[model samples]
Target: MAPPNLPFRLIRPAPDPVLAEAVLRLLETPEPASEALAELAMRDAPFTLALLSMRPLQPGEATTLKRALTERIDEAGDALLRAWLMHTGSQQLQADAVGQLNMRAGQVAETAMHLAIELRYPRPDEAYLAGLWHHVGALSLLASTRDFPVLRDQPATALERRQAERQRFGIDQIQLAAWLAESCGLPPTLRDALALAGAHEEHVAGAHPLARILRAAIHIAGPDATLDEAARLTGLDTERLSNLKTDVDYLSTEGLKSLGIGAPGAAEHERKPSGYPMLPSGWRAVALGGLLAGAFEGIDGKRLSLRLGNAFRLLFGKTPPLMLTVTEGQVQPLPMDTAQVAPHLITELGLQVDDDTSVVALALRTQASTSHFPGGDGPGRSTRDWHLARWLGTAGILCVPWQIEDTPGVAVVGLDEHLDLPTEEQQLMARLVSGAARALAAERTRRRAMDQLGETLMASQREHIRRVTHEIKSPLTVIKSYLGVIGQRHPEDPTLATELNQVSQEIDRVGRLLGQLAHPESATEEPRSTSVSGVVQELQHVYGEPLFGQRNRELEIRIPGGLPPVAIPASTLKQVLLNLVRNAAEALPEGHRLTISSPGVLITDGRHSLELELADNGPGIPEPRLHHLFEAAESSKGGEHQGLGLSIVKDLLGQFGSYIFCRTHPERGTRFNLFIPLAKPA
Candidate 1:
């Protein structure tokens, strides 16, 4: 099947005598000294070349293949043979150690493929590669440094282990694994899989089966792990898990034998039939006591609600339809859903309870199982119970109260009628809800501090910009004044006059830019009252001919007669229109025309506002950049434009309490709706 023109060699050459002797000496020993072999393997190139020779050799070019195998072997025979023997022995030892730890992990690729095929998942090849290379960084670290094995004794999570390795060495296992994978010419998919060692923390709720299985395989093989914990984490019941465990044990022993290492006989004694751990006699006391002692961990500020939702899922096996926080006689639903109940519903419930009876209102406040049956005539029955039963259509309600530093809050868990939860489960749910409240409270405090810091930084930055632009503008203004005087005095000298006028115009542009940058807040203030019709007439008289003449495009202004004055000054209106007109003209093609038309609809809330639409015939804004068109520093225009025109226009429009809405598509060209408030009748 080989192409005739292909020059790469496929055959591996035989070892030279000196190299063969070195391999013989290593094989002859009962156990080759790992330290000595490791020292030799440290010289990377010769060892790698020897391993390469075991595969089919490719000389690559015809001229290189022309040389005899003997000649190539003879040139580096002694050094290559020694390195090759050392490499082979060291590899065998490493495979044995890793196999002893977890046979499934040692032969991870083949085992992963076997599991994938059995499960009927797609891409067995990708799964195999993901499993095989996931722990390659650890193996590489062992080969390169003798001290790496000591790290195994440190009890740490996968993330913690990598951090410790990074602290001791210059690089971590994941980084090291990536480097080896790349050097061996493995695909990027393999490299990426190896890099995802601790990615399970991020996708806990809806992880892919491939990711879940890989995690299960590693955890089951890990030292100090029990079958119960691994099964729970992997979503595998005892019956199905027993078979997987048996397979892992058998495959691991076979893998060690294939690598020429004696099987670890002690492994048989450690095996146990798959089952949940026996509940410790005092499990409830221990678990609840630990919770009471504040043994839980905190989470990130931004993901408080999401993490709380996941916790709820863990407790109930399904997320509740609604979770509302009751604070200071008010009910606030999580932002995830806002349509749970009407505002009056919360107000009605809040009125029925006082501060002394708040805890009793939420039924599951303690670990005790207490329920209120609809017609029970129970000892502690109250009027509030009847109201709750009648309005909510529930015989009973469960609530858990959590306090953060003495600030009391209650979490109401909405339930379906069919589900009846036990008291033990209710206690666990209480612990989870309490942890969420603490985390949310902590996040809110941190966010408040961050907001204050951000405000201070913004104020400082604005002041700096104002000071710097003022310094620059002072000299530029003086220079423009002198240039204007020169132009007026030397009107007869056409060339000199023309140059002076051009200089003055450039200075004016710079001044406008500085003013825009130094006083952005000024554009967002209240607008002066002015005539909308008068502003439109001025734009037509001043810019209509000049704007259209240069681009050879039509400029049409269609405003109805007798329009009322709007709440925008003439100058502010002119600037906003100028930016819009220029933008339209630049975007339009030679044959395209820009039109400003008013439909004359008065939008009234407390006061009346008018709507004007600017339509243009041009290629529409690109989809990717359309959402960010009004944001400063984002641009589609390619030349000298710095993406400030539209951003400035947006800020100026805000000053008049008006806004622009943009609509565009490839076929429809573009349209902008400008909404402006009309002045009260005088």
Candidate 2:
């Protein structure tokens, strides 16, 4: 008989005690071997399902569930697997019943493998999985319902057993299994095979090939008197069928041996309770409160919903509560974007606030805690309550109303029907929800403030750029006009005219760069490559006199002919060379020299690049200063210097897929090596 108000929690059963112990031992190692864990996982049905449910299936994954699960086990790594094992291991199972069920599942799985091999089915592994999990619904029922073991062990036909389950629990094991398979997002073919495994022989004739194999294997390995029917379904003769049965029996015995389950005497001795003892209620509440406080301690605005869900998980153990947001009298789920809550739930649980039938709606209306059960009589109880019980795989639900400072909402948690919470625990849940709402509201306020600050900063930056652009353009216009005057006056001198034209072109390039700064979105033109030889000659002509000649420092250019063009515009390359040359000249003494050279091509990661070296014979930079040489700081040269030269040089080179490296010693002067990518050929 069904226990009164059975909890009907849809929990995956724990793994076999022997297997759990073995897995825990492996997890205790510094690095657990994935292959070893996978081998054990394949032998246990609940453990395999738990591993698969941890991750969604990838596109173009392996066709069979067994292969897919093997991949998932490797991907999950040891930490996640260990945590899940510990969580499930805390819930103990009745040893005799679990052992019997596990052994039957193993036998059925082995038999399915043999049948698929004989029939030459394409996916024999998937057939094995279908057989192994065929009785998962019964296992789940056994885990949640205290009196389920008697029904499971009773002597009855498969159909009669299903009828009994439906009568007692309002739903049969087959329905439960199908629902769980759907929830896990199992492949359609495998889901159909699992759902159809318990159907009658006639009902499964036209089913999937894996379904037929699973059905035949169940009949062969079970205690039902259907050996003749199994033979007719699989087209196997009497002798082969007998041999198959004998081999499966031998294999089942070997499987038990591998699991360390000896004969009855040793097996009974090994069947100790695997779960830990529960703490006292007061201590448990304190521990839970501490955990919840930690969950909300440093809530990040970006990850507010994730932290909230975690806090709820701490409050309500394995089954976390579902959260809904209320907005202007319209209620919907928190916008977690299908990652936290399944999509189907979002569709089904949307309710109007004035709908008198929903407990969730009533909680919002009265702004208090409310609850509903399957057979309860109240104004708030309706068909929707029954539907929610089935969908959540629970017998009842509790709705706790919360508000984000005047915006009211509700938190709905699935409850074990048999669980009776003390007043203190209920009050603790209310306080936890209140704290979560406050955290969320504070996060919202923080985000709004951050958004406003960002807008203000952007406006200030734009204004600064506009002022800087206007101030720099006036000087550039004056320089260009002055150069034009010099060019016209020196029309007879070709050398002077060329120098004036180069200066004019540089002034125009600066103007264009300033325009780009003001409206960066419009700067979409492709970058141009600069000829290294040409840029070197232009630098010598433009800044050779003022920077080095005026400072009594010698400048040497040692570039080879026929070097490839680098991936930077000529104007940008000139600016970079000017910055380095000016810094070197300023740091060098009266007679110190700077040597600029192109040291051939470099191959890095299969790409060709040009290496440019600027070496100086000035005093070497101190070690402390060299470490942060490129960072902007107070200028060691003081007067009119902002120490932005090297920093700007670094930023400009990075924009063109180039890098800068420095090396120096106390005796030897400093060297800056620039790696500039060679431009692609047109």
Candidate 3:
């Protein structure tokens, strides 16, 4: 069947992954896949023979054949069968041939099972199924070639006939079918059978289990073949074959018993039939109680205690006694010999085992101050056993952890009902007892460093607050006294009256000392959602009392009406406008234009959530202090400011997530942008 350019091979090589994948997609169409294979078969005589050889099987057996094909494809995990079969027969894999081949396959399986069972193979059923399907390729070829006169007629010998057929054609049917299984990635057992079909010396030398199975099926299906002789070839006793045959037949038709699979999930509802020991009555309580007390402390006591009680009921078949230890920190387990540990335990107050109990080991790894435990009310001699027992009595179980704070290195928690200790816990206790010896020493090293740092910062803040307070207050007292003297002398004199008024103003100027207190919040509000145009109109009347008159200032409004609202609070917007414009008023030799605008707000220029810009014509904002303007007490060169106003503006804007920044150049008046988030609906 090779093309002119193609080299001679028993079967074509392979199909493309893309074409194979596409074939699976095509399979979903209602058109019959078997029809496709049959059509391909018609065009290729040899392939046609192989395809037809698989039909005419019983219905149940046909289903099994379909399962076998699925098994083959799954094991292959290939997406290319589509392309490979296109030249051969894609439809051969479907239902038309599925039923007959599947039934024949089951018959093969039944025969193999019988043969293997008679042989006493441990896995008789598996051996039978494997044996039955071993030479599917050869069987398919034999069936398809049967319609040919020479092939259908009796041959002097099966092997001789096969060789004769091969000589006449480039390859025989068996060879071609065998090649097909290999190309399709059939399981090893079936693949080997393709090589062994003729009972050739090299191909059938050792008679693999599958080959033996095929030999038995041949005997069962061929009346002339003797069952005893065939059974002997498979290492099976003829007497047992019939029974195995019945069982295999039943399995093929009725299915394997689910319980016999021996997997756990399959047996979940059934009690284990055998194999186990009588578990110790209180091992869980004994083990878990120590771990719980050491790890969680008093809060877990009730839950852990309940768990222990339930464990006791399970083990004893009745509820039994269990112990619990409740302490603020860890309930340690200590054996009787822990008194020798106090001196070392003073440091590192953490969970640890004590020298006494071999079963209970420390479990919690807490982060806490590990200062050496202080000596008790007074140190006095006490027997180690009595002391440890008292700890056990008080804490419920005896335990030891290095000093948690300034406490005993070990405390007793509880005794488990198991009344036995684990070897590991005993070792942990030894390590704890050893570590206690130096725990306190480490605490002393850390304690010294902390004490020195605390003393230094405390003294520094004290002196700084004191020195500054006195320096500022002295002049204030003198100013108040001078004002008082002037008032008494002037009574009604114009000169003295003017002098007194100046003193009062000086006091107010000095009172800006409040900025030194860092009260950024105390500064009045900033410009907010207040009407930009209306505010400009009312400015003169509102501030008439303090103005040298908006006189020299040229007020300009860049704001457009009906603009989207800003986030500014009305009161704060007014206050901020007053301070900025007032500062601008103070800066100019005379009045200058003030301009405000409506524009998109930009964030990220500063940390403010929203920003608005206010502009003025007075000598541009100084470059050096532009960024620092928001810092307390900052000032522009040659321009004196109380400094708190801008700082306070920054702080008040912070409340509503708004901010202001200025863009200014020598020729251009400063433009201060005020930004705020568009407010969300309440």
In model 1, what are the clashing residue pairs, if there are any? 9-57, 9-58, 9-59, 11-57
What is the number of backbone collisions in each predicted candidate, taken in the order shown?
Answer: 4, 0, 59
TM-score of each: 0.40, 0.55, 0.28
Better of 1 and 2 by TM-score: 2
For all candidates in order, the CA lDDT equals 0.55, 0.72, 0.44
Q: RMSD to native for every prediction?
A: 22.6, 11.6, 28.3
lDDT of 2 by residue, 1-682 (tens): 1223434544567787778778878877887766778778878877776765555455434246556776666654443354345445445466456556766787788899889889998767767777777877777787667777778678998788888888888778777776666655556776787778777678788887777888888888886536787777788876787789889888777766776764222355554543434566567556555545444545564455544443333223424466666656666766442234564565565567888888888988898788887754532457766666556666678887777766787777777565664465565666566666676667767889999999999989988998999999998898888888888887899989887887787787788889889878887674579798899888888888888898799999999999998889887788888899888888888988999998899986577999999999888898878889999988888889998999999999989888889998776798999888899998
Q: Clashing residue pairs, candidate 2?
A: none
Q: Which stretches of candidate 3 lie over 4 Å from their true place?
A: 1-400, 404-540, 548-551, 600-611, 634-641
In model 3, state the lDDT of residue 326. 21
Cα lDDT of model 3 overall?
A: 0.44
Q: How far is candidate 2 from the true structure (C-alpha RMSD, Å)?
A: 11.6
User: CA shift at 331, candidate 3, in angstroms?
Assistant: 7.9
Model 3: how far residue 506 lies from native, Å = 22
Candidate 1 lDDT tens digits, 370-433: 3444455642454544444444444455565555576554555543343456555566566666
Query: Which candidate number would show the highest TM-score if scored against the true structure?
Result: 2
For model 1, the superposed segments whose C-alpha errors exceed 4 Å read 1-277, 281-381, 384-393, 398-423, 472-533, 536-572, 583-640, 644-682
